[model samples]
Target: MDIKAYIESGIIESYVLGLATPQEADELQRLSQTYPEIAAAVAGGEQWLRETADHYALPAPEELKTQLLARLEHEFQPEKQAPDLRYYRRDLFKYAAAVLLLLLTVSGLLNVYLYNNYRNASRDFVRLQSGIDMMAADNKAFQAKLAVLEQDLRFITAPGTIKVPLAGVSGREDYFATLYWNTQTKNVYLTANHLPAPAPGKQYQLWAIVDGKPVSAGLLNPNCTDLCMVTPVQQAQAFAITLEKTGGNPTPTSDQMVVLGKVKA
Candidate 1:
């Protein structure tokens, strides 16, 4: 149990002021017996209430005191009618003052308790809202990735999209890749199928042969696992991929060529 929080919750004040519900009063009584801090708090509250009552007790007026004495003297001399209430008026006023002070103190403590509860609730709401926002952002990113995959699937399966298989060369026979060319739209896409991962500070670059000379077909992303977009080519007799430095070079290195395939006539 949070002893400090419980002590500051105003339960003890309510219990002392006779305003706590039966269940709350019972719980406080049980806790007070089990916890020394709670017992001390309850005892302190009772002592403070006693002191406040004594502080608010007003001295009876001299004239009222004399009058009460005179009335008491006549009570034994003749037939005393009904008992006069003026005799107990002073005690009644003291009791009322004590009760009023206790009530005001209880109200202040109750306000403090309510404010604490409000602050805690606001903090919980903020944490919950933050979690919801993070989840929404993650879900949005997943949706965007799914949309890209769907678009790639459609592009590969569409009509007029030619699939070209580029086989390994220069003793690297195990290396292979595929190229997709949309002849009608002139769009090109490539997949590094069965190709080994590039080394540090190195990437792959694509080339298209045009009129017996090589033309830049853009660089391949090192992390790409699916269809990666490549620069379009108007006319190409063959397509080739070569290992190059990061960001690639303007010209393909003939000795570093990994895969090549001639376009079908």
Candidate 2:
């Protein structure tokens, strides 16, 4: 079996991204135990996802917590009711029976009013609880993202990782990118530093020059805002990128070349 070809087929990526079918994921798990290369590729892909997620992670606004607290305080606040002073009437002895009846009627009406208020308060409390539950869910999600970001930072900063800068070619001098190559594991990661958005239905492709021939590393996602993992190239003399169609071509177009850089010796 061609291990390299299988690794480059993007099954590992799909598995890492949760896009692989259940059967395919099971097969990948079985294969990874038998092949170290597959296992490494899977691990590398996960690290790339974490790193990318970290790069794009946005912190919560500084005033968000204060605003949420203030809103809640205002929403659940109790309303004050003034005391009834009609009970202390001047003609108390003249209409005792009438006053007693009026008092009974008023008591019944107050009970009904209080009951309705309790019901409404219960409903509002439920709605507020649902919102709290949603916010809790969001908080958990953010915590998970923070954990991934930490892991990504540790992975990228590990020893033996080499950074290769790819400068723009002539007439495209402003474009720039960087390649993170793990020499120990032969894993390659790409980060687009500065490049214009691709035209409609167009994309960028990466190439690794090996022995004077260009090999397809992989295609770059134009909307990629963070680190991107490309196909591992163990014996590349240099790396370059060229504009290509949406899905990319088997060979890079020479005239469309945008960036090129050599691997340091």
What's each prediction's clash count?
0, 0
TM-score of decoy 1: 0.56
Q: Kindly report which residue stretches of model 1 are placed more than 4 angstroms away from their true locations once superposed.
A: 1-90, 170-176, 193-202, 210-213, 221-226, 245-251, 262-265
The candidate 2 region of ten consecutive residues with least summed lDDT is 81-90
Q: Specify the poorest-scoring 10-residue window by lDDT in model 1.
A: 78-87
Candidate 1: tens digits of C-alpha lDDT, residues 1-265: 9999999998888899999999999999899899999999999999988998899999888799788888898566545534445547867989999999999999999999999999999999999999999999999999999999899888888888888899999699999999999887889999998889989988899999998888989989877788899898888889999999999988988999999998886
TM-score of 2: 0.55
- Give candidate 2's whole-model lDDT: 0.87
The number of the candidate with the highest lDDT is 1
What is the C-alpha lDDT profile of model 2 across 45-151, one tens digit per residue? 99988998899999999999899998898577445433222444534644887888899999999999999999999999999999999999999999998886776
